[model samples]
Target: DWVTETIVNNGEQYHGLNGDILVWNPVTKRRHELTSMGIRVTKKTLKIQLKMSGQEDFLNLPYHQALLNDEIPLSIGGGIGQSRTYMYLLRTAHLGEVSVTVWPKILKDICAQKNIKVLE
Candidate 1:
């Protein structure tokens, strides 16, 4: 709600778009970047980001056009996935020990048919 609040308080359409939240891992006794994410940009913020990054031309793209026209929803999305996530969560002996995401359903069926525990 800070974005909304920032608008209400200052009449500015900007949101701080840069920082990230990190996690501390006790096992390694170090901080780790679990994911990267952002509050969906306001039209103004999007313009600023694009301009600053020398990608202002992206504004002409359909996705940006839709956003500026308020046709699509504001979104928040990011994730930590695959081998690294599995490695930390399950403490697998090696990268191959865990499936990062879903395998194809066909693969799952084949593994099942072979009595192999490959999908997890």
Candidate 2:
């Protein structure tokens, strides 16, 4: 899938859920996804997302209405660290101290044990 719009928990932007995990290596000059996430749309989520997109006519349909009425099981899905492009590029061991780094004891312990270096 290419450039598919995704939304999460009434989020503003659709983080890539039903899509591929892309990895772009600037040093190696390559882009790839380690794995692909399958269809992750539930009836409840779909209706909300469609409504947000201003396409609520889908709500009138039986399948769509069933979702809104909570007649179907919610689709359990989401992206796995799909939004961590920068940390991957920098080759950092942890994400706690990069954009808004707040170090926890476990992270500190792991960094110490693994000899992982983080530059502030």
Candidate 3:
């Protein structure tokens, strides 16, 4: 996890200590952005970010109004890609190798030609 900070767009904000993770695979020479997470923003900072982004109209929305009124608690949140994590841990070259999901026929055929088994 890298310590980072970012201004929120669409009424989201990070109060402090925000970061994202970029996982690298040496064999495939690929990097995947795995997650983005951070602390919730304060009303003051929310207003500032909205003004900066020229999105103050968001304040009219119910969710934004609640945030500005301190109806929501400050908290930390993030997203993670489950299949990507599985690929990294299992050292798989392709996402289909780690998780089962629908794939384009062309993609499946290409992987097949490459002698890559895609688990559907």
Q: Which candidate leads the pack in lDDT? A: 3
Q: lDDT per model, in order?
A: 0.60, 0.58, 0.71
lDDT value, residue 56 of candidate 2: 77
Question: Which lDDT tens digits does candidate 2 get at residues 1-120?
Answer: 212567667677653445567776554455644446655566555755686778878789887777668787555332324324555656654544344555677767887787765444
Window of ten residues with lowest summed lDDT in model 3: 1-10
Each prediction's Cα RMSD? Answer: 9.4, 13.3, 8.3
Give the per-residue lDDT digits (tens) of candidate 3, residues 1-120. 111344567777444564557888864788875555544567777777787778989989998887767787644342236667777788877888877789999999999998888988
* Model 3 TM: 0.48
Candidate number that wins on lDDT, 1 or 3: 3
| Cα error, candidate 1, residue 32 (Å) | 3.7
My TM-score estimates for the predictions, one after another, are: 0.45, 0.33, 0.48
User: Which residue pairs overlap in candidate 2's backbone?
Assistant: 6-14
lDDT of 3: 0.71
